[model samples]
Each structure stands twice: as structure tokens, then as C-alpha cells.
Target: MKQDANEFSSFAETIASLGSLTKLESAMSAAIKSSRVPAKETRKMLKCMSIQEAGNTALFQFMRDLFEKVGVGQLVLIRNDIFRYDFAIDNSPVCKLYPHVKGKKTCYITAESLSQFFTKDLGLPGTAEEIACQNAGDNRCEFAVSLQPLAVYQLALDQLDKTIIGSVIDGAGPDKISESLEMSRDEIIFRMNILKRYKILDDDYQITEIGETYHKYGEGMGGDEEEFQPPWKDMAVISNAISASTSFAEAFTEAASQEPLWDVEEKDIVNLAEQAKKSKSFAELLSKQVKSDMEE
Candidate 1:
């Protein structure tokens, strides 16, 4: 049997982590920046998940529902692998919209990020290709997550190392990255040297072509799907947080405080806070996000 955790709801944590609605753009920017530079550890993290676990209709449904619950859009699972994420309210403005401008440049970042999320989080094999876009005057945004073969897994970077590489992609020096990522200078130096040894980083701490290619295509094409890890929820703490709160705002704050990893929106947090004041309403709200994660 799996251990029961005393954590807050994952949905509430996601909302709280989003920061203020006013700063959503910056958060999105940060997330985008983080995605551009891939680290070896990121690849390792991705490799931990196998294809058998990720390549299935049920996993796709979970991903689809996750997006919908987060208010990103209404998801239509067109096929086992393909999906249409209709963004009625595009929270990720980083996915540029070329509405009046006549060009077929869809939300490449969004598509790629989704690809990475599926590749890394789910260990599914596919190119998250963008087929349609609202920005292109389409009714919705469509993504063809083609089930394909991941060639191999050939990177071995650790978490801190990957963070450094990602920071470097943002054009930050090792020292600056150290400050930004809160890593010690010595640790940054060590990781940079390792990356350099692997030809992932040049002597000048720049991303080599191989490194660039790895970052660009590795997530979509490398790791083996046979070792995939399933998605999970951390509910106990958030539930306890909610249970302990005297008011909706405190509950919201407690939930938000638990997530330092991702960004969230104030409107969502406020909405969730309002719902969480009543147990029945809150559980119902959580069921929409992730049913299995919440324990009544």
C-alpha cells in the first residue's frame, strides 16, 4: 500500500505557487527561460520515467484533464496521443499570438513545453507538434503528440548541474547563475567543468552546438519510455493546511507557501480559497483537478 501523506492539495499548491496575477507574465517568462536550456540532470530526470508507463490512453487523459482543471483550456483528446488544447484564456502569454499578423507561427514554446512535460514527466515518446492555433485564426490550438520511438538516453547531469546549464542559456555567467540559483560558487565551478568535459559547455561557459541540439531535441527524442514514472499528487500537507486555517486567505497562503517550484495566478488561488472554506466544496474542486490525490 502507498503511504498517505499529510499534504495540501496539488491544485491548491499549483495556484498558490503562481504568485500574484499581476506578475504572471514574469513567471511565464522565467519558466520559458528555464525550458530553453536543458541540463543533463533534466535528461536523467526524464530518463527515470519509461515509455510503457507513459504511452497509453489513460496517461493522455490525465494530462488532458490536468490542463483543463488548471484553466489553461478545454482539452479534446483527439486520439490516444494527439490532443487539442483550446485556450479560451491563454495564461502562458509566452506562447506568442500572431493574430493580425498573417503567419503560421503557432505557439512553438507551448507546444515544445508540452512536449517536454510529456517527455520528462510522463516519459512518453513523441513530438508534440502544433497542428492548429487560435493565433492563426483557428478555432482552437491543436497538438499532435505522435507516438514515436526515443532513440536513446545518453546524458548524465545532476540537478544542480542542469540548473547551471539552464541559467547559462539565459546568458548568465557562472557567478551570476550561482547567485540566482543560490548555488555556491565552488559547486557551480565544479558543474560547469563537468559540462565542459562532456562538451555540453564550451570553455567560455557557452552552450556548444551539441549541447544546444541536446537541449532542443533530447526531451522529444532521447529517453526510453520503458522506465517512465507515473504522475502523483501531494495532498496531505495542503489538506492539513486547509484544515488548520481559520480563514480562506490563510489557507490559500499556506497552500501557496508549499510550492516554490512553479508559478501560479492570484485569481485561481482566490477562487480555490473561497472553495476551500467549506469541505464539501473544496473536495469537489479538487476532484476536478485530480480526484485520486485528495483523501476525504
Candidate 2:
């Protein structure tokens, strides 16, 4: 009886020790389900990576936009990998909530939020870990995400985006890559900038050791990528609705002229109706700035 009692006592103590962590896990899950942070936002971030060619600064801005939309503030990208990402938040709110709590990682909610956001919302098979926390005397709260290889490839790369790598494999220069891929010289430059940002290609536009491995294994592996529904379906629905109504397109085109293309104002949603019209011609409008999200 004493032995059984001791075992039960140990189990109870274990649960108690993990009580806050479990509660945090539950809160993160509930927030994710309720917020339903659109997958399109994530897709937009990846798309921005390809098109903006503005490097980490642009990436950080997109993340800021995304996390702010979902009520997670001040997210900054630290280290980005093809199948992994590292992020940090400054002066974390959850940590601030626990002034007396110190000496250990206390930002379980933010860490779990990132994990659930990637796994549940983005459909990326991954988990995020809190590597550093201000409560633990770190300057910022850092979270690292490790995603499965093929799943990330499916989500991150467009079919044509791989052409640059293919060109590199064949000893093709930027000009050759551009000609083979039917992309403009400017577009090729943008793509090269993105490749360099990944360290996949070096200064001479040659594929690095990592790029060679990425080519050997990561390429042509996501056969089931099409099974996943794109987040742009909602926009497609609106497009279909407009296409269904014959008058909508003409009316939209007239208003779209007044609408800004890539530089749409964020604070003003008053002209969202006009923006929807622009979304119909999203490719043409973003043509100068971006090509497309993912061209199948």
C-alpha cells in the first residue's frame, strides 16, 4: 500500500511540476483554432521571399505583418533555412506577465503558438522550441522551428523557382538561366539575389555544397504538393464571383485604375472593394514587383 501511495505521489508531483506548461499548451492550441490565422498570410511571406529580393529586411517586415495580424507582436527572423527557421520576439509579453518568474524559460505560450501555427495552419510538419528567454537572462525570446524536408520544399518553392538551381547544375550563368527559364534579366537578378540570401549560390553564382545536396535530394520530391488546397482559394472564390457576374469586371477595371498596385495602403480598408477588383488582376498589377505566389 505504501509503495502504491508513493507512486501516485510521484505522478501527482510530476503533473504539478508541469501544470503551467500544460496550461500554456492548451492556451496556444485554443488561440490557434480561434484565430484561424489564414494560410495565405504564410504563403504571402514565402512569396515575398522570392519576389521582393530585398533580403532579410523584407522577410522581417512580412513576419511582423503576419504575427501582428494574429496578435503575436514583435517577431523577428534570426536564421532562416530551407527546412528550419529561427525567430525572436523582443520583451515578450508573456514573460512580462511573470515579473517574479526567472531563471528558466517562461515563454511557453509563444513557443507553442509558433509550433501550432506552423503545424496546424501552415501545414508544415514541425515543432518550435524556445531556445532562449528573457526570463532566463537572454536579451530576447528565441524560438527555432524544424520542419520536415519534403513538406517544406512543397510549401516554399514554386515549380519554376527550381530552374535557377537546375541551371547552376548544368553550369549555366544568370543569362543562360534566364533564357532557359523564359524569365527576364531583371527577374533573373531578383532570383539570384534570393538564391544568394539562402547561401545556396555563392558570389560567382555557382551552387554551393549545400545547394548541390538540395539539388540531389530536395528537388522533384513533392508529388503530393497539389493535394493541399492553396490559401488563395478565398481570393479565387471572389474572382469566380466576379467572373460569374459579367458586369463586375468592367466596373472593377474602371476602379482599379485609381487603385495602387504593390503599394496598397494598410490602414485604409475603406477601398477594400476596389482592392478586390485589383486582386482579380493580381498578377498584372504585381507584375513589376512580383510575378506570382506559386505557378504550380
- How would you encode candidate 2's per-residue C-alpha lDDT over 5-44 as one tens digit per residue? 2221232222232332333334334444433334434544
Estimate, for each residue in 43-135, the C-alpha lDDT of model 1 and write its tens digit. Answer: 432332233323334534444544443324545544331211222223333233222223343355456556655556543445666777666
Q: In terms of TM-score, which candidate is strongest?
A: 2
Off by over 4 Å in 1: 1-58, 69-71, 81-103, 150-230, 233-296
lDDT of 2 at 202: 89
For candidate 1, what is the lDDT?
Answer: 0.46
Give the worst 10-residue stretch by lDDT in candidate 2.
4-13
- Report backbone clashes per prediction: 22, 0
Worst 10 residues of 1 by lDDT: 1-10
120 Cα displacement, candidate 2 (Å): 2.5
lDDT of each: 0.46, 0.57
